[model samples]
Target: MAASGAAVLHRAVRANLTARALALVVVVLVLVISYATSLRIYFAQAHEIATTKAEIAQSQASIADLQSQITRWNDPAYVSAQARERLGWLVPGETGYTVVGADGKPLGGGLTLDSTPTDDPGQPQAMWWDRMWGSVKAADKPAVKKADPGKRAPVTPDSKPR
Candidate 1:
């Protein structure tokens, strides 16, 4: 019976080409599935990385917009307008008029006419590079050292030189 089994196995290995081909195809399919699964994981990670980069770009754009707004608001004319409208300050020779419409509302759009544009030519202009350098230097400077009380001499009232 063992001899018969061996003969049958030999005949299957040597004679049937279609059966061997099917076995090879099944092995290839398993390898392809495994590779495809790994590729899917890699692609998912790439998507996450792309999303993070997009968020970073968006944050940068927002920061740039905010910085631009700060630059504009820091102007002398704009600041003066804001201060006068918000604080109700009146400069000399500047007239204040309120024209109420049919609804009995001021046409100043929540701003008063007493606002003075403080455009002082004598004020020193700030250079962009100087400000940036100063900020960098300030950040690099070491913290202030605390006063050493122990190293200081004891103070006495009405003390004179020896």
Candidate 2:
């Protein structure tokens, strides 16, 4: 009986390989799960990169529009238009009439010109010094002495206006 039992134990040991196969399967499943997680992260980063690229393209288009506008403004006609609109510039022997509340449209009795100036009419006119120092910003203005005697009237007791 002891010899038969010993022989059975030896056979059982030779066929006991199920546990090792199960361990290998578990390892393979862990590795697959890790790989899938890494793939998910990579795809997410790709999506973010795409969105950022689209934003960059939009900003570049806006910059291009601004550059075109800047170039257009350098033209003489465009500059003249802006000046006439902003500074009330008119050709010689021409008139500039304002029709406030009309907005370049025909008034259908709801709005009419108030006869008053559309812009600040009573605003104090900028004096010669103010305009020279403010508007005509001649950075390269060389010091010029008054040469003509009449142009530089002397402020003395004997001097008088002509």
Candidate 3:
């Protein structure tokens, strides 16, 4: 009876040990899965921070470029040069001459207005006011209405009244 009692006590201790080890293993697995999710979130936030920093740097660079342009535009010499190149502006005492090629196109790099005479001698040229008056006359005319070809006429059922 003493030997049987000792064997029964040993079996109970072994069963308790097995259950405790399984519970410890399950707890460790849960902790590992939670830590993995946290690490993924941390890395994703780090990537987003890097991307936002790059965008901020780009915006700063663009702002610096625009500030430099503003500084250059504040100079009178730059403004005068731009006007001369873009609008064909000339100084009060300066006479500007455009060199024309045989094809009737301006040869040099400076901007030139369309001052060339018409090639047809028989056709009378209309002045700026004449063209403006013609446009005004056209605007005064009533608009002509036309039926849409794709539009379908309404249909009445044969069983109903005509």
lDDT of each: 0.85, 0.80, 0.90
Q: In order, how many clashes per candidate?
A: 0, 0, 0
- Report the C-alpha displacement of residue 149, candidate 2, in angstroms: 76
Candidate 3 residue-wise lDDT, 1-162, digit = tens: 999999999999999999999999999999999999999999999999999999999999999999999999999999999999988898899998888899998887876568677667788888899999999999999789787757846555645443
My TM-score estimates for the predictions, one after another, are 0.52, 0.48, 0.59
lDDT of 3: 0.90
Considering TM-score, where higher is better, how would the candidates rank from best to worst?
Answer: 3, 1, 2
Clashes of 2: 0
Which candidate model has the greater TM-score, 1 or 2? 1
Better of 1 and 3 by TM-score: 3
Could you give the C-alpha RMSD of every candidate to the true structure, in order shown? 14.1, 18.9, 6.6
Cα lDDT of candidate 2 equals 0.80
- Total clashing pairs in model 3: 0
Candidate 2, residue 120: CA error in Å?
19
